[model samples]
Target: MIGICKSFGANKVLGGVNLHVRPGEVHALMGENGAGKSTLMNILTGIHRADAGTIMVDGKEVTFKNNKDAEEHGIAFIHQELNIWPNLSVLENLFLMNQPKTRFGTIDFKKMREMAEAKCQEIGIDLPLDEIAGECSVGQQQMTEITRSLMLDAKTVIMDEPTAALTERETDRLFEVMKKLKNKGVSIIYISHRMEEVFANCDTITVMRDGQTISSRPTEETNMDQIVGDMVGRIMSEYYPARTNVPGDEIFRVEGFTQPGVFRDISFNLRKGEILGVAGLMGAGRTEIMRAIFGVDPHESGKLYFEGKEIHIKNPRDAIRHGFGFITENRKTEGLILDFSIERNIALPSEERLAQSHVINDKKEFDFSSELSKRLGVKAQDINLPASTLSGGNQQKVVIAKWVGMHPKLLILDEPTRGIDIGAKKDIYDLMNELTAKGVSIIMVSSELPEVIGMSDRILVIHEGRAAGIVEHKDATQTRIMTLATGGE
Candidate 1:
């Protein structure tokens, strides 16, 4: 992308944004939320057209009329959100657009399978030739996505948060594959909010802030703190603040938490002023346990104790009745109603607090949402603006603020800071510390190991639906956590 300019109505999301990639290099796009990184990629991949720009592909300038044109031009964009159909077989999803067959009205299953097998072999994926895509794990699904791009001869592959849902070993495998691609002269444009990944795997780095390119430099020439400072143009003094409150009596406890084929025999406690962390790989039962506790998922056997008495939470309503709140992992879908106003989405769970005469109190609703929005530092055009219009980091803050207004005795956040920029992450860490200081016990589930170590007073490590081990604040080592996470415990 060079001299790119794009606007959504009056908002100039991309203003003269410029990026480039070499034939055998990984170019990383780093930015705070809403820095026009996605917008620029959208333009390049024909998801959106630039107001004015020129794209140089292999020393030739090109313009794509649409996504199909971009694909034909040898560019493939894997969105931050996975787009594969779960119910379809892997072969079908791989050759989704155009299938190989003889010139006949009937489908060609034999030739399609043959070609899919060849492609999967070249890409090092070992999924069954006819395995259902949905039944596979997230890491396998991502590999399918990558193989799909290669089958189309996508010379320049663009991956957006491809490893966000992957395990440590899976991430290592992905990096290895990317290195092979680099050696084969396949340029990759990697976009991610994870600074460590960018620094580790990318050759060049470009930082964007507020729809502008802040800086672009060679990875070896810059450090993490400098790049972070450039991305948000600030020096973050402290990330996770020290908690001020004393740990009180246990506010919530779960014993014998069990969900058939998911997780079983789990027990944990949340003190009134403690931040308890849950750490594990993807599908390791961290999220499952949280969902079961919050009554979002089914539980065959478990005992949930709130305050002191055991409560049977048949649904989310019962969880709420027991003063429970959850911030889901999939923020775009599970957390917020995108089309609704930020204020409206934030006020959704708290409507009962302001209802009078079988009617919602609009004034109180707006007031509460507005106050929380301000307190959480949610960046938005207005409270009435649609939640979809906000940036990723701001949207996350809105989600947190929504539940904070509910005043739950226990709040559970699953991957609360995924895909958010470092500045916003520090802000969130500060917010978490503040919440814990106020006697609001927190149960946070995060895959980022550093965050698990930094924020939690204690951590519960799970694997294959069982509690592997537990560690205190200062004693948890990444090596120890990984051992238990991979089933060593």
Candidate 2:
């Protein structure tokens, strides 16, 4: 793509940007959220038309009017949000518009299943073709999306945050897949915020900032410091903020928590002003345990204590009433109402506080949301814009703001910084420090070992629905955590 220019009303999203990817090379696209990375990709994939630009394929200039047109040119996009039909079976989703037909003009179920199975084998994975797409894990769904692109015979594939929801082992598998694609001479446009992944897997790096290309260099020539500085236009001295709040006496504790076939005998204590980090592999029950504590899921048996007094929490409302807040892992599905305005989402959790005599005060709601937006640095035209309009980082800030408005004593953050840019991650870490300073306890569940070590006062390792052990920040090493997470003592 050459001289790509795009605008959305008054917002000039891309200002004369350019990108070049070679065949069989994994090119990494680096940028903060809203830096026009998605806009550029959208223009390239024909999701949106560029105001002024030229796309050259095989040294021939071509214009694409729609996604299908781009696909015809062997270009495919696997979006960050996997665009699989939840109600449809895996085979059905894979061959939705391009199913094989028999001599009688009927869809060929046997052919479709055979093709799906062959594709999975080519990618070195096993997937049930008849299973519902929604029933599959995030990693499996990702593989299905990739298989679809390959089935289209795509020469140029674009993956946006492909491994954001994947576990460490799953990420390794994805890297292997990418390598196989490269060996087959297929070009890949890799977009991600994880610097480690970029350096480890990509052959070239392209940095974008403020809607324009800053620099593009070979992976061998550029380092993480240079790439990060170029992307964010600043030198990040420290990735995590200093922990200032000293933990106080135990304020929350769960004893013998058992959720059949989920987690069992989970026991832990959270102190005031403490940040307790939860570490585990995917499917190890880290999220399930937190869900039980927050009353989103019921445990078969458990004893909960708050400030040394036993308490009962039968549902989310009960937990919320007792000053508990939860930031779910999948923000798009569970955290925010995509169709609602920013102000409305911010006021959702605190509706009772913003109500008077069983009626909501619109003005008060607006005022509170406005204040929270400013406090959280949510970038938007106004508070009345739909929550879906904001970028990933801003959307995440809205979720945090919603819970912060409720002034909860204990906050549960599940994958808090997942898919966010590095700059936004720093802002969240700072916010966590500030919140803890005010005596708000935090329980953070993260798959990133570096983050868990950098931010947590204590790290609790969970292995296959059981607590392996808890390690102090000073003693928490990646190897130690991995050992415990893999069921070692």
Candidate 3:
């Protein structure tokens, strides 16, 4: 990494950026979600410092005064939000901040569980070193934070979107532990927005646009439409829109839905200008059927409807007075309230829609949160800052413009562009085709699968919460939605 300029004040997020990784190949870097690839990996792990650039390492010229001086020069990282510490253990999160001592000074727990069970068997990470890293699964707490950065022998690791919440058999055991850390020569870097995990496990790639360094090639001659036409100069067919449909009636239904250990017999319907995607695999309940249809879990058995009536949502303020709006899938911990702003989290469900009818209109809630924050462009430096200071693709467009100023006819969303990037996933697929051309009615919940086969018109899939069938968005097929999202052939 060299000349990696950065800025937040005037927002030049890493403009002079340049990077190179080699030692034993991998490279990657990529772009799109707020470009600048996590500000050049938080300035190569010193956790933000480069107001300019120059880092070097192995060729020497380094500077990381933090992240334990970039893990004592071998560098480390992991982080696409998994920082670990879920009530510890997995051998205390693989040696919490480099432990191991005891010449009677104590704290070496049998040489850190014999080096975290021999570095979780040299990274194939099958778990169980005294368990409880929050009792596992989020792809085993992201491979125990990448096996606690190779038990501190790191040598340039990095990672970031490590299989955006995994499971294709846990991302083929993390590409067989990145091919045994590139046959032990080490280097990595990686970071991704998933062009099939940088063309199946990078051997170079780079890209990064808007914040500079437009190309770096050689993943066998760069392709994925030339790294998305050099990271969004366009041409990926104007960034995916096609999934057309014209269904209308049904509105929203869900019969027989149970929520026992999490799911069972769930059903579906969702029409009236529909979208519907859903697909599954990670705990296959597809975020517990959008948290049991937005009432936030309370489905011991179910049936819900709208156009044909039958409602009783019972909680998220009776599913926002039966209009419903969800968006969830961890947009900064269950969708924003982050120190509030961006027009006070887009005027908070208009405070129970104006404290239960009439009289709380601060200029019509700042003109309806400045007209849905300029119809969802939402950059920042106004609408009152905070929302934990924007940019994770503008904090996921302020969590879909905080439920699009709560108008909702039936939105639901869930994994809305999960870890964001491809130019903020094409401005969230042009704000879901302008909220399905304003008639509204979405349902989405996705684990990518080509974005539920490029924005559904009826896909469904699900598996352990039942309805494993639905298809027809022109007879979909990511191998038939991975054989109905894992119930298989």
Q: What is the C-alpha RMSD of each candidate to the true structure, in Å?
A: 2.1, 1.1, 20.9
Most accurate candidate by lDDT:
2
Query: Model 2: how large is the Cα RMSD against the reference?
Result: 1.1
What's the lDDT of the predicted structure labeled candidate 2?
0.91
Better of 1 and 3 by lDDT: 1
Angstrom error at residue 379, model 1 = 4.0
Q: Write one digit per residue (lDDT tens) for candidate 3, span 1-489.
A: 778787878867776888888887888888776677877887888888988778888777878877888888788888787777888777788778568899988797988888777777766557877878877777788877777787788777888888888877878888888888788989888877878877977898888887888889889986787788788787675557774547667877888878787788887788776888888788877887787778877787788878887887857878988778898876776788778777878778766665535566676677878888887777676887778777666777878887877878888887788777777777777777677777788888888878877778878888876778889887898998888777876
lDDT of 2 by residue, 236-291 (tens): 87889888789999999999999989999999999999999999999999999999
The TM-score ranking, best first, is 2, 1, 3
lDDT of 1 by residue, 401-428 (tens): 9888898888999999987778778888
Task: Give Cα-based local distance difference scores for all models.
Answer: 0.85, 0.91, 0.79
Per-residue error for 262 in candidate 1, Å, reads 2.3
Cand. 3 Cα-lDDT: 0.79
Question: Model 2 — TM-score against the truth?
Answer: 0.98
Q: How do the candidates rank by lDDT, highest first?
A: 2, 1, 3
TM-score of each: 0.94, 0.98, 0.34
